[model samples]
Target chain A: MATMHTPQIVETNHPGHWKKSVKTGLKYIPLLILIFFFTFPLVFMIVSSFKRDNLQIFADLRSMRAFLPVGELTLDNYRAVFINSNFPRYLMNSIGLTIVTILLAMLVNSMAAYALSRLKWRGQKLALSVIIATLIIPGQAVIMPMLLLVASLPAISFEGGVIALTQGWLDTYYVQVIPFVTSAFSIFLFYQFFQDIPKELDEAALVDGANRFQIYYRIIVPMSGPVFASVAILTFISSWNAFLWPIMTVQSDNLRPVMVGLLFFFQRDVQWAEVMAYTTMITIPVLLFFFLFQSAFVKSVATSGLKG
Target chain B: MTAPTVPIEKSEGKPKKERQIIVGLLMAAPAFLLMILFLVTPFFGGIYFSFTNQRLIAATETEVVGFRNYTRLLSLSVLPLEPVVDETTGQPVLDETGELTYPRSREITRDEENYPQYAGLTEWFTFDVGDTRYVVLAGDPNFYRSIVNNFFFAIVVIPLQTGLALLLALLVNQGLRGQTFFRTMYFAPVVTSMVVVSIVWKFLYDPNNGLINEMISTLTFGAVGPINWLGNPSIAMWAIIIMSVWQGVGMQMMLFIAGLQQIPGSLYEATSIDGANTWQEFRHITLPGLRNVMVFIFLTITIAAFQLFDQVFVMTNGGPDNATTTTVFHMYREGFREQKIGYASAIAVIFFLIIVGINLIQRYAVKEKEA
Candidate 1:
């Protein structure tokens, strides 16, 4: 009787284990569905980018075959994007502009933030308040007047190997890069990060005969790598993805960024596959950057939310 | 040693203070200068321009119009339309389609001497109150439409995006295996440029031979349709909203995830010990814990919704009968495309005040909730 009871208990418990595993699997169903929904368009884009033509793209749209890299896959769409358009130039222009903006923004905003948070000065509070107050003014509000102002602002240009004074800053790299370098948001981010560092480090460096500049350079900056990384990534993404300003300011295709270039490409009577290829080309660099610095990217955005 | 040191310090202190002041000024100068040049100046310029007839390329000197631009933008009138009466029968006339017939709205709006306030006004919409049909007139009907579109977008998008973001945050925060992969996949759209996303979605929304319609048709066994997503005025704005939410929900989700992590785990443990279920834990703990994050996200999303231009410009160009026109898009059209700089500046000024008003109200509401 004892042996029969023990076997009965084991038999009941075995199915219970199977049921628990099934319940756990059920929990993942929603997550998997969402992942597929969110990632499908992008995956479809990349997969279709390799197809031979719009005919193939649409033909495969009704089946799982659309997502799979099959049925006459080719790099011709990518080749056509480069050969038929100014995409390569636009890509290069965007990269250069983004790099320059990030570097300048990091340097200038960090210095301002250091002055506000670490150094002793008169009116620092007022200055900081003024800067942060500007955050409420959305860029759209100023864009019209900004266009007029930049159009009339003085700039120097090299013409035929001779330096000449120019009246307008329009249709130039300077118009795109210079006005965006000194961001109030970047300064605020740096100020918040710098405020948490102990002031004793500055005092320690100062007592060792280091100047304020030296303290900022040696102690504060080196200690604030995370914040700097955050600012750089934030600036990189914004500058890379900039559209309204560049479209208004840049007219020359040689100076236009990838966003504007994509717009022009879309407006033309081009094939759908080429459009996908163009978009994929522009998106890869930013995605690669995001994946490489995933944690920093997430942290920056999260902190930005807490800024309010 | 003390006396010598004290004397030396007294001599150095004043100059040191001056030097520090100078250095601080130097450090802050570049950013301040740029801000003043690009931001402060343009802001004031916009305000000043709004009061004048400042064209982009001024053929004539800009004149101070003295609230004319504002009047043009904000003017409105509502009047009851009298249905046309049949001369022989002494009864209200009806059209062949069996609707009450009234005189054209243009005639009344065009009569400047009697309806001076409605001089430039056009018919925006008409509705009936009992037996009377009232027509809403506007100085700029497109502007009114843009405002309505912006509000409609904000109202729909704020709640939908916030709820979805919270759900996603919760899902990913459950310590599930492959959580990182899930989070990354969800966030992939946020990193892509709005231009690219808009274009990609435009293709998907194609009326014929598009993926979305194909899927819908297949699922319904070909009963539903080849819907013209963007070309249809009624559905165009909704299309834009869906794409915008998809593109943006990830950022808010990341914020919520961070907020979720900040909640103490011990609260949940205590709740579980008291026999609290999943729904109860979420309602009591998760919702309250996310209040601040929700407020922040709501305000930001609302502000962004008001500034909806990129997708409209790319996909619709405020087309399909002006259905998707936004304040920013309208301003861009007036200011840049039409060269009506002063009028657009007026729009910009109003847009700025609205944003400021929103921020103030949000701050007050959040503070009240906390208290």
Candidate 2:
């Protein structure tokens, strides 16, 4: 038995094992090719950003040298993007807006979702259905009137360091943040997650003299970490990536988001390398966020129930 | 088992139910109010504004011009669109009313189409009778053109993106090595802004120095001249479409992969036991399994296609003579750029109706499929 075992082990560990390894590797060739196809644009974007100019990019387009980090690499493009453009301001604006939007959205949507899903109320079914129905209403369809509405809506703002009532929401940070805070999709997500939680827990909490709000605050919200994270990430990504509304509303350079600031590069001369560098910078935060919560993102999107 | 009786706890909780109703309303109030203010109001407001001649910076009084904008967009006429110039000045002739007049005749060999001059020269309706062609231009050619472009974009992008996504999902659904890595790579773009994608693609589509043309030239051994991707009107929309598909296929792929996982392995195993080939198994089992997901994806994609704005806005700006102009792009231009709020509102209303119509159809289809 010992002799047989030794021979079997030796055979399994033999140099001829490469054939089986190669066969296994061959199975992944299609997946690898697809990965390359999918990732090449981004890879090219990063690689080409480090290149000197458009001419260099064109010259290296055909060869393996295009993808390699071998060229007249310089920080000049990055320097130009910062020095000549409002990229920093745009980034700050987006970050601030995204944070506030996500926080408010989480609170508001979760509260609403809790009420709709957990609390017993009159017209609860109707309200939930109405909220869900709004998912089908594409933002493009209502943007025109929304523009008009925002333009005419009253706002409170600071003038000369004093609080003042403003007539319109045009060209302001509040306009960017406020309208997006109460998201129906986020609420729907919360509702779905909250519905899955056991009603017995709520009943038990109630029997212990806990109110609905107490149950929600102490029990439900504490337990619903995954859904909260999902909503927060999705909401943050969306608000960060907001383009059209910001463009329509925000005219000032200071309030512009990174997506809008991207156009600043185009309005001037077309510096391909610099533009690429700028795009990479703008894309990095989203990519990092995605990588960090990749599974959560996939899960949230899978359970999103519907899309816009 | 206890006898049927009102529990003392249940009797005491009567006020609690009332309080619950009040609390629920209070909790849901802010979101409901915001939804009304932001979404529902605008929806009705769009319809209201469509009938009025509301300009952004107009000093004049706003008046409801019933059906004028819609008719302006839809009206058509058959006329010989010939310029009347001064004959003595070696040009065509002017009428007695001092306005340029076309010599209108039924016997004219060539029939030119005409529309409201605001619609541009794009509107044309052609009919041929005994080798005499009659071309009639629609009132708002731009609107019609945008609709055409929207339909074209939808028709091309949906199937291509969905098919590519389905293929990726199917491939990755296999228990392959580095599956998560492949998924992450595929889904990376879904997290990025559409504007970023457009900007990157725009750089790639540049006429002289873009990588796309450069790669194409190298692939063909310099036999083909450098193709003007965005510059050429014929290919600009397709360029945008390709980029959109790239950016969007990820989400659809993820959805499909999730759908695939939900499918019971036992079904496939049973089919294989019956000696079913891969294609046969896929057709009978996989396709049917993914029906709901496919329908969902189809609906969302169709809606997205109609709402194609960000990429077009960033890359083409409805440019190269508006060849890539979509419906939303047109609405944006009319409303924001041109400050024609009322006209744009009409477009928005029509777009809403179309979207509703599509969703209803989708719902009916899903229901029918289940039935």
Candidate 3:
């Protein structure tokens, strides 16, 4: 065995190693080309955002300089995006609402999934199947009626210590957060994960005189780190990236998310650099979030097939 | 011990059953309430709204007009009107005011001498009800066009994106250098918002100062002029398709990679021992192993393609002359832009059916293939 391994190591450093190395390197050419294909557009966006003028971007388009931060780069576009728009407000709205939504979703969806997977009761399977079936129904199919529903929903408001009853939930933060708190996809994912946990632990907890909720809170949730991470990342990305719903429901600038705020640039006189800068800014958070929870995100997508 | 155990177990079982029911219902209440309020109610409500004369601005009275919106949006099997003609002209003569007239008389057929102008009508289906004549032309041409556009997007994007994803996944499946870096970089756009992708690609497709045209010019040595990617109606949807494929290919790639990792390495070694070459091994082993994953990717990408809206909204706004107006986009425009809530609801209902139909067919196909 030692002798068999020695020749393989020796051949790598042998006299004709250069030829072997070249062959291996050549195999990666297609991969490099693909990487360039995927990365170049995003690189171009970042580079062009730094360029001062639309003319400058156009002038360098014929060469590799369009993707290189070579000449006349500045933060002027970023400055303009901050000063001339409600981008900061949009960013805050997205971050805050995404956090609130994720927290609520985790609490609510986990409980529901636990019940569906662990508890034995009448009509439990029927309820679980009914929830799963909704996954096939696209949101666009029901968005019209949802719009009408939200428009007529009862709400409560506080103004200067005076509480008033309101009829419509549209144009409110709850409209963005509350309706999405109990998604079928998230519940399904939790159910799949919860099924893997050992049932003997639940039996032990029950014998200890713990209630079902206590068993869940004390035992299952503590052991479900990976699932929570996956669900949190996926939910955060979606809520942050929500565009169509926000546009339909939200009319005020303060309530707009970052994705919808990109349209604010379009409504103005077309400024390509500022648009790129705004997109680049909004994209950085997503990239950061993705890199931080990269494995969990990939695992969630593979196992559950939920898209960000 | 046996006597006490039997009595206690019987006593505990009754309350346990009751408690299980209570606990299950209590835990699941929130999920059921939300789904019922949002998804189930709206699903049936949307279908109901399609049949009504509901306006966006609520009225004191909104009446259910049976099948009128559906007939107006799709084709009507029976149009209860007959042609009005004058004996003097014999050309289905106009009324006294020069209006071409159709009056309620008898159902007419395409075989009739003066069948209402079926000239240049591509979308028509006809069935007879015991010798009463009926010819169907599309009541709404734009809606039909939108459906065609949706299919076109799905047909082109699904295969291309899935193939690209599989190729990428295969490349990085081994213990290659910088494997994690490549995976993360490829998945960057998957995390990024669709709106951002559309905006960036819209800039790239700018006819005058766009990067794509400049690169094309350089590649061809100026033989090809800058193409109006988003401007020309013919190529507009194609531009959107390319951008969408780029934005979405990453998610599929990661999923494929996961699928690839699940295949046991022992099979490849066994194939090699049998003198199988690399291509042969891959063809026989890897492709067959990835069958289920490929079907999943196909179903998902196809469904997403059918729901194409944001890219069109952000990049082209369904224009230069509504070229990229997909079903969802048209529904949005009708509901929000034009405030034709009833008509838009009808579009939504049809869209729901189409999606459900596609998913069911795919599921059946995959099940059959597996069996």
Candidate 4:
């Protein structure tokens, strides 16, 4: 995970280094203590997640008491979530949505970016500006209107507005994935990076009889893999974690994503243990994905000046 | 380059510009269309509906009336949104404009008569709670209490959350051991479902058997026994705020860490050699180094906090006598719960304006300072 640091910063010793070090060290204590203070809640949550029952957790939730206790180790809760509940399906649903959205987003955003940044077109700046402006407008403001649009689509629509769609937009896979495919931020991210890439390659490709699509597909997209990975990681996390919009739209139990499924499962007149198991399972994929590619993605962002 | 499909005319015009523009439009068309249809159109429609009495559901048609929604929601004398402020003037607990911010709502407790005018409006809107004629009015006294309460939360929690995030960032960025683990742990909640967080926290804040109150009872001082974390209207806001900070600290911390990582070590060393103390070094070096990050994080956090909805939706529902109701939640209630879409749209519009204004002020402040 280590990367090259600015050389001058590598030598931190100063002439008054000892006295400054003392002060810095002194300052670190209170700061560290405060970090512990703020992080105590998370500490409690993780500890509680392992408990076999509530009594152990309640006994010493804040302290490390519960975690240390020789409580009965049980897989009952995890079993309940994995077998007794819809958690698996929800996980699949979430993964499906996230993967679909990620692929769709990369294609749409990169293509849009290629057009905006690499294509020497008049109004390229205008297109770029529009993409940036999209960032300013909050999504909540238009949710209701967006709901109407979702409900009114052709194949997705219900009969004569008599009801919501039959195989309606409600709970349909496309319904969940379609509205989210185009990300303004991703477009802007790639657009900025593409602008940095030399355009002479484009002229050469054009001279070699390459059509616009080939130039983008063969050259630009391949060269921009690092950023594409970063944007993909971000989109996957967001899609997996998204709660509100999905909850408001998706109605069928079969189509429920992990987050909502976990909510319902936890509230199932069941134990917190099962809930923890559900949460742990839901977190597994993202945790695995994050740990795997985070270094490469972070490097791309740092070098490219793309702020999340 | 096929020598330009139409070599001569294309060569004269360099037609690359027009073709590129066409490709740009085609590539972006879907997203552009969605933004307009889903975002901009609904916003304008929401404003229009805010003027009428629109209810959800297909069976019912809305009655169109100009300014009636506003007329209906006025807190006093049937007037809506009287500019309210926090008590003990200039406190973050209360905003400069009257409204409950929610995060720092620790300090307000109300007696029944505290907001009599608001009570009258609710009574009028509901056709009497138990037999009095209800009047819908702005500046109504009863609802005003909740407004003040909301301001308290926004002021206290917003800054507390942001400050704590910055602090954690500074600490965690000290080239410490297990840095990655700590960062991931801290960031867990940011990625977890807020509904789950809110529900779990609501259970924790459950007055009698709840962990927080239990801890308080064991403490040596300060009303340690059986404190009503959620039940008491006074303490409910703060209780919610505490949970919120816990739920949200991860994102801000991550952003700050990213910011801190960008700081140059040489600057710190140079300042140290110049014989500056730690605090002075922070003032001159750390603060300045993180200025861009600080501004971005600050503005982002504030905006997110201001639009507090999901947590409130799952946890308090702006309840325990409306102590935790925020501007956004209030708009939600007015539009969806009460079937007053027009009024809610007005609230949403005002909320939108606040967000935009805050962004503008941030932009100006940062630009001017940087210059």
Fraction of native Cα contacts reproduced by each candidate: 0.72, 0.74, 0.74, 0.29
Q: Write the per-residue lDDT of candidate 4 for residues B1-371, one digit (tens) a residue.
A: 32354565476595665675577677767766665665556767877776776655444777778875555445454422222335668553435685343421111112236644333243223233332333343433333444455467668876898888887787778775566766666665655556666766765676654666665665645466777787788787888788888877767777778777788889887766666777998888778888887787667766676667777777777787777777767766655556555566766666677678778999999989979
Say which prediction, candidate 1 or candidate 3, comes out ahead on DockQ.
Answer: 3
Determine which window of 10 residues in candidate 2 chain B has minimal summed lDDT: B114-123
lDDT tens digits by residue: candidate 1, B250-354: 999999998999999999988876767789999999899999899999999988888899999999999899999999999999999998899999999999999
Query: After best superposition, candidate 1 residue A154: deviation in angstroms?
Result: 0.5
Tens digit per residue, CA lDDT, model 3, B144-256? 77898999999999889999999899888767778788888888887778888888888899899889988898999999998999999999999999999888888899988
Model 1: iRMSD?
5.4
Over A239-258, each residue of candidate 1 has an lDDT whose tens digit, in order, gives: 99889998888888899999
Candidate 3 local lDDT, residue B2? 27
Q: Any idea what lDDT model 2 has?
A: 0.83
The digit string of per-residue lDDT tens for model 2 on B147-250 reads 88999999998899889999999888888777888999989987777877888788777778777787788889998888888888998999988888888888
Q: Score chain A of model 1 by TM-score against the reference chain A.
A: 0.93
The better-scoring model by DockQ among 3 and 4 is: 3
lDDT of 4 by residue, A89-130 (tens): 888898899889999888877887777666555556776777
Candidate 1 error regions (>4 Å): A1-16, A305-308, B1-11
Q: What's the lDDT for residue A301 in model 1?
A: 68
Best by lDDT: 1
TM-scores for all predictions = 0.95, 0.89, 0.88, 0.78
Backbone clashes for every candidate come to 0, 2, 1, 45
Give stretches of model 2 more than 4 Å off.
A1-23, A302-305, B1-10, B13-15, B77-122, B125-130
Clashing pairs in 3: B82-B103
- Model 4, C-alpha of A294: deviation from truth (Å): 4.0
